[model samples]
Target: MRRLPWALSLLLFSAAPAFAAEGLDGKTLGLAWAIPFLGMLLSIAVMPLVAGRFWHHNRGKVAAFWALLALIPIALGHGIGTASQAVVHTAFLEYIPFILLLLALFTVAGGIVIRGNLKGAPGLNTILLAIGAGLASIIGTTGAAMIMIRPVMRANDDRKRNVHVIVFFIFLVANAGGALTPLGDPPLFLGFLRGVDFFWPTVHLFWPAALIIGALLAGFYALDSHIYAKDGHKWLDPTPPREISISGGINFLLIPAIIGVILLSATVEWGEVTIHGTHVAVASLCRDAAFVAIVALSLFFTPATSRSENSFSWEPISEVAELFAGIFITIIPVLAMLQAGTEGAFAPLVALVQGPGGAPDNLAYFWITGGLSSFLDNAPTYLVFFELAGGDPQRLMTEGATTLAAISAGAVFMGANTYIGNAPNFMVYAIARDGGVKMPGFFGYMLWSSVILLPLFAVVSIVFFAG
Candidate 1:
């Protein structure tokens, strides 16, 4: 309650008398980013102590607590009438369920795929992860992550030293590789909604993606080589390997269908429509129906035995659902305030980079944001930095090739900085835990990445991007 006065005073004193653009406050996009981000930081700092004391025994409960705290700022409406209304509505209605549905789809897909590949050969496992990462360009990050994570984790089973390899795999393949297409990451897709040419990022991000991929492949090979050399005695079995063909390779078809639905929804203008005489957005109705169809098809068509064999209980996904419930809640308010501050002028930093004298500084900001994303949720963090690169009174003036390149690089590569930075990070960690790898918690995961991954990225920064 006392905090309310301080917050109001800050807003009143700090609020501009007004802006030339009316809705727009006419501030630097980067400054606007600080609003929600500050809230995120405050939540992050407080969450650990709060959760440790009250929710000590339960990570799910702790996540819930923090997420609710994050929602407070958004709930207050950020002092903006219209934008705040939209945010409050989106947070409670759109965002939460969107996450849940996505999580559900991912869990189902991963469960189905990984169950069959539980005993996949080592080389095959490497190929699967690599292919999955490559496919992220086509599907979104979560799609590829869901399909490939279990197989990668299972393939690495019984190998203790090579666990971090999975972490890097999630960083590069599942997350960063998706930078090429709007379909790859949510922020880029949001860019697409705002008028970015869909194919542009793919062409431009190719070089940066290659650089990061090359670095990761080398790292994986080196790490795997060391592990293989040390563990050669246990490498092969005298008995011939059992064939593991997918029983429901047909079930996989549902995935593409799901993708098509999303694409169709994006393309069609289903303004407001009545469903059973109820008012709702046409786009939303399409989404819900599509997901329901996909889930129903998978459940009915899939063999009952296959589910049991794969341990396809709802438990693992339940955990992911629980974790994100909190994450989304906490970040909503911060995003609202940040959005209010920026007033939708957030993506012009790319133009600034190519502007008279901003490329070098803009590039530096990209690296810092990416580095931070490795620890923080890269979604909002990406937006923050993406907006910064956008420049003052930010606008998407340029094609965003260079800026998109930087955004892709940071959002994807730097996600390796921490386990929770990207959805794939948690997915991989969950798979490992289910498979018994005993992955580290928040900071512990960062420590490992900081010591190992960050230095390698530094080399990447110096050699490929900065140079």
Candidate 2:
């Protein structure tokens, strides 16, 4: 209430704000403001690989440090009131809701466990990958991976040459499969929150997703067949295989319940209320509240055996929450700069994506965004290119549909280029390694993506995005 003075000053400084929703002014800002955001992303990408133990222990603290680097300056320069607006606006609108959805998905997936083993024949392996890919859009990539990966590993545990199965799983289940719906991946959900329709990705991305996933499944089946033949077509069952048992069966229902709430939020309008000068929709409030409820309900009703069997812990979601808080805070200035378009510091980048006659080049949008998503967290990368292309959901969904499609596909699919690209990619890798699947090393994994995914992306670019 007392922050009106700084608020006015900051408002004045928003010389050329591109987004009506954005609070920060990018025209008056410079590249210096990007340091914290860049630092935060680099920490996420590099620290764990280089300083594994230190990162494990202090990742939360590191995130806080970068967030403070941005917040402290804002508070001092714009006044506590203005800085408070920045935090409140981004938190309520993007970060909190994003975390809540992920938390709900994480909790539900952890509760459901896949039991029993089957022969890891080429046909069965291909079918499992196909199922996981289909399920990715419903249960989320992380959830599907959590439920499906164990069965896959168990099925192929006896195979002498089975790394291809896990690698293909990482490509399809962990990344590309998630391209079809907002529930499938973090980036799409961010799009939804930013006013993209709940089914926008489903409609726009379905074909591209089908193309990549089908291609991956076909490639996987062929590779697995050759390998299976080498192993003498062994249908050799591993140990005493029991019929698949379902634990935490309640979570299956809860997942649809989670989706229902989000859908309701999108479908129904309940009005808006202002908090600290920012207006928030009632449906959004209800949706977030439902997520909290779902989390609690999932924890209470699901069998304890389900969690213990899955080795479930709060750590994964905890890390996600911590890292994203820093990202949402630090990215404010970056978005502002990108939003500024040719008038801002990122003119060169804007130019790079520009094609003949000043139109956005779909191919550039695909590769550049995907290239960055290969190393950076794909969610934030999506938001960056999203804002870069223009922050209007209406425009992006209509006249800019092809460009938006390119951005969405690139963010979701090329995340397989590196383990760090998406939350589930590295996770599946670590789990596979722990289960003794002989997963490839980081660069070696990139080599796989290079030989397999790069060519496929080229075909995608030619087929859908060439402009």
Candidate 3:
């Protein structure tokens, strides 16, 4: 992967249709960007079948290998095309780092304990659900999903028919829960980079997050009660209390790591960087390298056994590694395409709020764009819509607070809409399935969301964003 930097210059001057169109420079650019992205989508759709048939014996290794393959087209297509350098840099430096942060945190937290021996299924559900939500911002929605999923699944393992339980769990824990912090989800992380204050999401959206969780728990209780009643006879022996062990809760170190990275980025110069013609910060590169090294070292050297006597195995970590490797590889190209398209053809979307009905139109734009994010990649979806919101001079005339509020809120909240809306949803689903819980298919999962999540989000829309 280090060789990727070598191709940067070569990718810059490559000739392709994306750069050849006369009156459609933007369209050409969009297509070039799309090359890698489309590759990713295809990989996701087809890789499962291919891996299942050809590499079922070692899906993780196959997935990891293909993830690397997915990166090739993205690097070749976007790295050398007539694509915008700004978008490319943003994709790699800003975006990739955020993803990596969540990944590292998820891996670390997954090492922690979630006592599966607890009785009172509802109580277990509430605590795990709360933990998932609280951790979402720090770990990224996906990270929290990876950490909590096995335990959540374990808690409800016998209730196989109640798949909605898992689906709704994704809605709250993996998606909406993260809306309150940049660490929570990619969209908010983008906001953090674009001048939004750190801690802003927590201050603004905590209540809304609480409301969503409250509603979700209520729904879970009602559903769980019915399921428990049906499965009551089957609830034979509640697992005995055994200490499940974990390490790396060194919370104090996280603060310094974060500060050190920021300081380092501020001090060095990066590629294509220009600071009074001197250079941009190279600290980002160093920070990223150090961050990765620290995480790898911690995971490697940390004792696999907890002090309580329970031992750790690589099974869960291996599963996350395989699946996320696939995801990271495949999505790079997709993000490249989205970033390319966001500027030209996608520009007119900004005009949606300009004509006639004004603020109400903006509100509609908010929901529509945000709702789409629930199904699409919320990060880019966030950037596109954030641009749309910011592009409006009238919106600028309005309070900055209101404008930022709408953009950040929509991007963060609506991510809960689907299984793939945020990264963690898939991790949670994947981990649960690994524990023998049957996860819903693409559209089937949507059906579950519609029944449980939609109504609750609708309430949020009314209470918070219905201006």
Candidate 4:
């Protein structure tokens, strides 16, 4: 389409340089630099429970307030060069591309209208989540989640106790199911971009991921069945079942375009464009350009009724974009500290992952990477651990295969531990809440992940990741 060419040309107008400066020296930054980041997370976690009305109405304002807390100090303490470089680098090299990918996936997937609601029987519910889990590897977790979540919700819309179902969906479809492929999750995709073979996760993580996914599905089915039986199974259907149909099928075409854009960026190299000391590949810029085209095309071509009928709203994506913007900016110091490794503040964190005789402890790698990823953004967490473990793909793939597998599984699987743990987790939470599912609040959701997934991951570590 003509739109595609125009969008490609949009890449010519790159982000204006913000003047390269010496980067934030994490070694010089005290633990106090992490205050904004921690406060931001606490605000997200506590503000909702304490001031539900205020948080709902002014989430963006809260996000901005914390973002400034992160920025102003850097400008005052470190100077404009460091501040500008940090924000610009994050905006260009990381956050924009991150948001664009989510936006394209969210737009394209949201347009798909699953026309009829089926009875949300335990058996049918299990099958739907299972199908969604299957699609996660192929379409990416966010896409799979966006496409499947509504229909699953619709089918269970009549149920009195449906919250658990959505929780398990978050666990399986949004997290564990994404463990098997680079395309399945952001962390693994980061791994792929860093020179891990494309099929590496698929091969190494298959059994461990399968075991976790299968266990979650089974647990969800059992829980749903028990709840359904308690509800007396004879409740009047809110909207009686109708013949299933899928609308906006044409929008599905954008999926491959999304995949192709990512693959193009990864598989090809173009000259670099440095913006504020961050060198972004021209190909990555073009990829972002292509995503803009795909989103526009999706919006223009898809029938408006398709989204309206599906109860799709832009609010979820808007909230995610706003909140994650603050997160990425504030997290600059935290990531830098981790990146500083042994020389920086969290040096003792380095020792935990090292076993007797200085060999890397696979299980410790799994737990620590997972624990940090449970709170920090998992993609960069994966990258940090990847560097700590020698940063050699060839060596990691062959001799340190188990260690690589542990990091991969931890980053992908433990992201379900909290709403903010994975991008898709929060998006799914917002959408479900909008759909009137009474989704759990931040810590409440953590309780669910702790009770269900933590034990399961323990089994996985013992079986597969033991050093």
- The numbered model that scores best in TM-score is 2
Q: What lDDT score belongs to each candidate, Candidate 1 first?
A: 0.55, 0.86, 0.56, 0.81
- lDDT for each residue of candidate 3 in 1-467, tens digit (9 for 90 to 100): 23223223222222232432111133344434444334443444455444645543465545445544544444455443323333244435554455456545654554555554444366567677777877777666765676566666656655536476677678777777787766677777666655465666788778877898788877777777777667752645345555664344553255347545644564456655542222234555566676677567556655555312223334434443344434444444444333343365443454564446433354655577678677665665666555555534234334545555656666777776666566566656766676666788778887877777667767776777655
Q: What is the lDDT of candidate 1?
A: 0.55
Position 123, candidate 2: lDDT: 91
**33, model 4: CA deviation in Å?**
1.8
Candidates in descending lDDT order: 2, 4, 3, 1
Top lDDT prediction, candidate number: 2
Judging by TM-score, tell me the better candidate of 2 and 3: 2
Note the clash tally of each candidate: 8, 0, 15, 0
User: Which stretches in model 2 have alpha-carbon errors above 4 Å?
Assistant: 1-23, 233-239
TM-score of each: 0.70, 0.94, 0.72, 0.85
Please list all clashing residue pairs in model 1, or write none if there are none: 67-330, 70-330, 74-333, 348-390, 349-389, 349-390, 349-391, 374-418
Candidate 2: 10-residue stretch with minimal lDDT: 1-10
At residue 278, give the lDDT of candidate 3: 21
Sorted by TM-score (best first), the order is: 2, 4, 3, 1
Q: Report how far off residue 286 is in candidate 2 (Å).
A: 0.6
